[model samples]
Target: MPPEFVLPNYVLRVFTLFEQFSDRLALVRGERKSTYGELIADVLRIAAGLRDAGIRPGGKVLIMAANCFDAPALQLALHLHGCRALWSAPITSRREIDQFASLADADAFVYDQTTELGRELAQSLAPMTVRTMAELFTDGSPYEISATPVPDSVLQTSGTTGDPKLVHHTQAFYEQILELAGAFVANGFPLLRHYSSSPLWLASGQITSFFNLFTGGVLFLTDTWSPEEFYRVVSTERITSTYVTPPMLYELLDHPSGEDVDCSSLFMLNVGAGPATPARLRQGIARFGPVLRIVYGLSEAVVVTAQPGLTEDSAHPERLASAGTAYGDVRLEIRDDDGKVLEPGQTGEVWVQSNLTFAGYLGKPELTAETLVDGWLRTRDLGYLDADGYLFLVDRVHDMIVTTRRNWAIFCRPIEDVLASHPAVRTAAVIGVPDPVVGEAVHAFVVTRSPVPEADLQQLVTNTLNEMWTPAAIDFVPELPLTRIAKVDKVALRNLYRELHPDQTGHDDAASRAGEAR
Candidate 1:
């Protein structure tokens, strides 16, 4: 017989905090506010329900839901019962949901009744026990916390690939978050009234949600995201911290009521998930005071680097382009293709090692082996560290454009940055399109606040970089396509470009020849 597994001390500590702050408000969803007392009781009741349902300690339970008041308690209950929680958001396509369901191999499926996708998945993923949130919480039993199997989780990536990879994390990940939360409190950071639209299925959401709860702070969960709602909630609730992607931040800045909003209560506005243009960052700084904290991380390693209290450094104006230095016991290094560590200021892939790094990819050993090598996670992001230790990300290895101009490697971020620097350009995205002449030509999509001629934009890039890096073609767009998680969807952009140019022969042969000539 196997020995009994005990819940980690960190989990117990969280339960203890819930008890200590029983009457304190913990979660706010819509008009409903829940106290820690209610949250803890809900967790225990759900755990009892799981046990009554005959799910063993190590059983894998798949969950699909939107961000709601019940989500945090439900996830905690799953972990408390020693079940491997596999969480998926309901926003994905039906086909993608089916794929995720197939990959889950779960012993049971649980979902929120409010979501249409949840109802559809519950019907489709059958033969196994399927229960809605209401069913799971019905008729609570008297259950006590005891030693059980160690809990773990499998989270879906943000769909950077055709098939989203499942990232596996163990109790250690939560323990690290608890430690970080403790540090946050001890350091006298503002008591977070955190507002987040990111659900538990995403790594960003998990950190934001748990980091607040663990510190005995209020967490406001919202299902939808809009600039107007964000402003309303921040002002009304006095939200101290929140997170947003670059695209979302742009919307907030461009909104008509941005100048009128009472955002003085906000202490931290974490911007991450992708690069924000330096020009836009300056705008944010000018408006929000020094509250924008630029975070750089991925699902594999959540919170590797953070530039907190972002300000425009007068001596180093270029620091606006940096993602900041290593964060919280993280070891960051730049490595060449050969795996040799590069000197500071040398461009290469970014590798990170930290307690917060994920365990491995679920059911994909080959990929896990490739991504996690020798205790370090290969970020697959090209960047460099300055002599002062600031990290500057150039591009993703896959996003680089290999031009025919002496087979030069061109990164889209630099070109996008140059275009975004223009006063008229609100946001910009660059992609590499197939070109018979230049091998791969740089094509840009710009969303502008005012009319900007293509010639002027082309000349800006030419002056900022060089003629070789100038876009072969430029398209004016109302907005850029974003992924489910709000990062710029380059794949969709490529498909759009292809749709616009069915011939697929090339974009601007004259421009390509001109660039080659330069």
Candidate 2:
């Protein structure tokens, strides 16, 4: 059957199917299993408890926990009441938590951590109620929850606007998601048996868990990713569809158990959170068979596009660099500064409109207006769509490094794709620094295959890019720093480099950098 042209309401959601299939297994975490009946009952119990605790319609609740079955149910309860939730975990440092907690101004917070510190901080916070998981479960008749009319533009923006800001979504947002997920399940959505390693608080885990619950699949999760532990889980439980980031995939492929672990049952491997390099994408396709799926999305919206099957193109050979064709009620446009659509081969900001886009930012109205203009959220990313309409990303607009000799973005992805063309260099990121003469000299932070001379890497850069755009120095780093969101934190990188190399000088652009470096 063909998909419907329009979806119903926000309340008609991704988890509605689970209400009937009461006895099936839904989630597996550590040593426990949550049946569909158990999951549903828990949702009602938790929602009732939250309502009793004064959580009402239009309230924001903070859920500080990982991707346990309860976490998803708690989120459902919040949604059922037309309330929003912010997922919390250890990865979300206390500082980030305080920052988001302050921004959300949530009426209450649910602390999942059994640690003393988690309890202490929640207790200390003023004007906000705190409930533990035990409390959330044990208490019945928590409150009088409401189902109100959610606005069409009432979507929250994920961190797509360069800054981690909120944005709005239509009332029919999740219904759009359910379409794709429901389709996948109808066509054989393998129950995930070894998914114990998702980034608990974020959308990757959240979306995967929601899909599992709706499709009658099993979802397992872990606090941290471990190669040995994952093999044990997959072998022991036979997890079929798993969500993994590029780096974690690299870790798994390189793991000793990677070869020994039986992956015949591993049906669907969803890779996103960041763009996968052509080489890595190829490697994944080869090792995992054709079961790889690449999703392109931001926290602000559900997945904008996903290709169930990815293939290598001989002509451009860069098809692997693409995020893939747009999918399910999504619009992709490359627009210039004047809002003019750019021609193919021309670079511009990527703009997307989807039913899944969120309500709006929590506290920052100005930020929300700037991003969600005229119902389109302009992703502050620089990229060009191929003639075939495939999206290819270059860099974050903010992450671009403006220099004297070269006016280009410092994207390690292109370099990684090009370096993967070479035999010696393993992975890399190009950081830019101000120089007295050349203006902005790019420093290549590299992880090498073996000991390679700096001159060789310099030549490689010169060969892959113009001499002007070539990296000035190839500095080997054992490991690059990552943000809580897990992308290479260039903001932190620039600060760290400037602080250490103060004599090197720092400036915004070529002219200012020239004076400073001089």
Candidate 3:
């Protein structure tokens, strides 16, 4: 057997290099910039205060804060001091905080300010140290702590269907920081100035704050995602790299600023968190140059596969729909329902094996066992591999819609892809709803630039696909609902469909009648 994986001791030593790179800019938010030395000093001070406040090795601390420079400093302090930190998005509700508090077995709850709900959560988590950042940052005697072998972080899932799952990351996850940092050194720092608007609690937020800092790169942090602000930053700051979810990407592409902004400085615009359509990929390449990099990953598995750099003129523009080949010690396989691996070109569940695979969901062994089997993470995402090893995602297993009208199965991704190709449509999402005639009917929600008759969209799909692939009814909306992770929330869309159509029957007739009225 291979030697057991161990985190390198030098992980903490990198931060000490503040003595050498003291004057270099390490973090930038708006007009304010913090040099390497300043960042390290702040982290040490906050850490010392936390240590004085009884936070110790093996203790779990819950950090609920918005996007800011202080958040990353606090996380680094917690990790260096051997404490596991759970960072929940500040937008999380009090009831959700209670769930996280229980799962983390938290020793403390940290927040910026107090609210009615925050107070309620604090009261429920009695005996847990609950303090504001100001209180925790009180001046204290200098303290030094060493990293331990315990897990360093807890990440929660997007929670589309049920309660959000808690994903734990061991020191093995942190060790990758060194590996990635080394790669940056070798590659001459491909991503020097990065920007991200993800909240401090989510995984996307952690990417820019931790990885960029680890590589001695500058990070541009933001509290919220705004297209206008994003455009101004990229054009003015010369941002070389950034990350955006599918929905956010759509917004950026559709924003008028995208046409006028000087985004030529961007070298890498990593898009992930959900599937992106081919049309959007092409449009992004046109607007942002050839810097659109498609990343496919999960909260459980940090980085599974990524399309390094895609352009319209690339070797496989058709492969633009495919999540590129795997990289960095990751192993991928497509498997069927019986846990049997499938051959290339056969669609099935995508399973991954990687050192970065998370420890497991916190406090749910059965769920963990179901997800992680034989050291392989069952991604639940349905996809296949090409002969060249490129992974093509179809749809989430649960997102597949079966049509009893023709006794055939319909995948929402392909339908949505065709819908996106339409000139009038900006973004589209497809979900299945109950129908008396057909067991399940395909329902579509779309955002369009201009009013297009419903028949035009249906005709577009009909021209591109078979009869069964057509949507039973099309509902045009200003925008689609998105989860915190920024993926189109099909669950919420389904709820909205139920609300709009109370009886949920006669979709075809409903469409015909609506057409007549129009």
Using Cα atoms with residue i matched to residue i, what is each candidate's TM-score against the true structure? 0.95, 0.87, 0.91
If ranked by lDDT, best first, what sequence of candidates would result?
1, 3, 2
Residue-level lDDT of model 2, residues 165-256, one tens digit each, is 43444445656656766786677755555474554356556566666666677777666666787677777777777777666676676676
Over 4 Å off in model 1, which ranges? Answer: 1-4, 158-161, 506-518
lDDT on C-alpha atoms for all candidate structures:
0.88, 0.66, 0.78
lDDT of 1 by residue, 1-518 (tens): 34548745356788887898899999999889989999988888888888888777788999998897798888898888888999876888777777777788899998999999998888887788888887777575687777778888888864444566789988889989988988998998878999999999999998999999998999999989999999999999999999999999999999999999899988999999999999999999988899999999998899999999999999999989999999888999999999999999999999999988999988789999999999999999999999999999999887788787987899889899999999999999998877877778889999999999999999999999999999999989899998889999887887788777768635556533333222
Off by more than 4 A, model 2? 1-16, 88-90, 115-117, 139-171, 187-196, 406-412, 506-518
Our model 1 lands, by Cα RMSD against the true structure, at 3.5
Residue 433, candidate 3: C-alpha displacement in angstroms? 1.6
Candidate with maximal TM-score: 1
For every candidate, C-alpha RMSD to the true structure in Å: 3.5, 4.8, 4.7
Q: Which ten residues in a row have the lowest lDDT in candidate 3?
A: 1-10
